[model samples]
Target: MPIITVTNHVGPTYALEPRAPTAASATLFRNFIQWNVVNAVDGYVVQHIQRNEKYWVQRHFPRHQTYQAVSVDDYWECWRVTVAAGVTTITPARDLINDKFTVVTVMDAPGADGTVGRFPDKTGTRGRWKLRGLVYFVADPGLVIADWPAGGAPSAGLLHSRLLPPIQGNGLARNRQGRLGGVLFRREFAGSWDWTTEDQRIAPRADDGVGAPPLVTYRDPVVSARNFPALAGFRSRNIRTADEAAGGWLPIARRPAHG
Candidate 1:
């Protein structure tokens, strides 16, 4: 998510401070410089990120030898990858966790003489620097309860869900209303239990004006569970460890239909 965010910033700084007489020329030169620089950035930046990561992990895997694995309970927030990687759940888009992601790459330009340049910008070297895949993620600071697994299947459809009641497009859910205070539950009393938990939207004022706001999904989390015909699943960027690729993955077996 952070990688491409850099595209917003690219331009010439002080080329020896633009001279008064050459203002037009300077501006033209700087504009040309900016266009070329950004285009150069985009050419390699766009196409290369997706493939590099797959190649790295699956082909020539790198091991974090010194990296010590920690228990989920002891690990930091970002370090927590859900043990439920394979245990798929069908939660609402917003309910799923691990929402943000980014791609980064390092380009290696090959020189005319077939030599690869180690550094491009600083050396002003002309070599062929190709783009490679770089995967990055952004932890949603707004996630209220995120114990979801890492590399969780990406969310399909409109992955970004909002907590707010429908203000535009679809109307608010029947049970949802102003400033969602909290979800209500019913309590049983007799043979025919009370309908107390029938679902109601209570405002903060309803609880003596001091209860915390009810947490809602600010954005949809990635999900992986469904054979929906019309709708499609999230596009996965598959990567595998070399060891796991020994025999290659087996195809998912299909089941027979029942009447």
Candidate 2:
């Protein structure tokens, strides 16, 4: 699965890096979240954070086991842990604990660092990552509108490499959820492909940034919303924050986000 990493920049001093779960992986986990949010607020609000959290997870480190409890570790995985008494580690150490979940400690780990704890059983070659980071956001009650997914273990501060520079303006050019801005989300593959080989990988001949169609073209399978129960009763107007950038909202017409 291709990973799409995104970052929320705040000034030059802080940022938020969420975990990146592939659209495919998200489809798999949608049911789990929907089941949990069934009795919560309108299912729309429930779906909002569920999808957003997937984006948040890709760029940040896994939340540790505070005292010892089962948690939804990443988009596609859940974890159960038992912390040693008095350990009081702010975060879990990024090591396997009792053949169960991996622990990450805040002192030595931060950002979106550990893959072992990112997703369940991610010890495979396709999942190895070295560093991680995080940022926090409090969604505006009014902007509780709408949602969005993926991928690789990127280094700290580099999560925005694929993003175009943010448009400079005054206070909140877009609404509380960043609705009016043009934020491009991209997917990058490094080294060898995880699910397919370099030769077999498809790349459709699309116009390059230069304007000419590229020579290589590949096919990317579409992730259907039918697979996600969280989206069962979702509506677009309920989550939309503004009127501009409607193209960006196609996927929204298509996803929630967490705060």
154 Cα displacement, candidate 2 (Å) = 17
Kindly report which residue stretches of model 1 are placed more than 4 angstroms away from their true locations once superposed. 1-101, 105-234, 237-259
Q: For model 1, what is the alpha-carbon lDDT of residue 11?
A: 26
* lDDT of model 1, residue 88: 25
TM-score of each: 0.13, 0.15
lDDT by residue (tens digit), candidate 1, 225-259: 22222322112213233332112221112111111
TM-score of 2: 0.15
In model 1, where is the ten-residue run with the lowest total lDDT? 67-76
lDDT of 2 by residue, 1-259 (tens): 1111232222111111223462222111111101111112211111011111111111111331111111111121111112244231111213322111111111111112232222221111121111111112222231222121011112111111111112213211354553322212211111111211122423334433433322332233112111223223213213322321222121221112211
Model 1 C-alpha RMSD to native: 30.5
Error of 2 at 191 (Å): 19
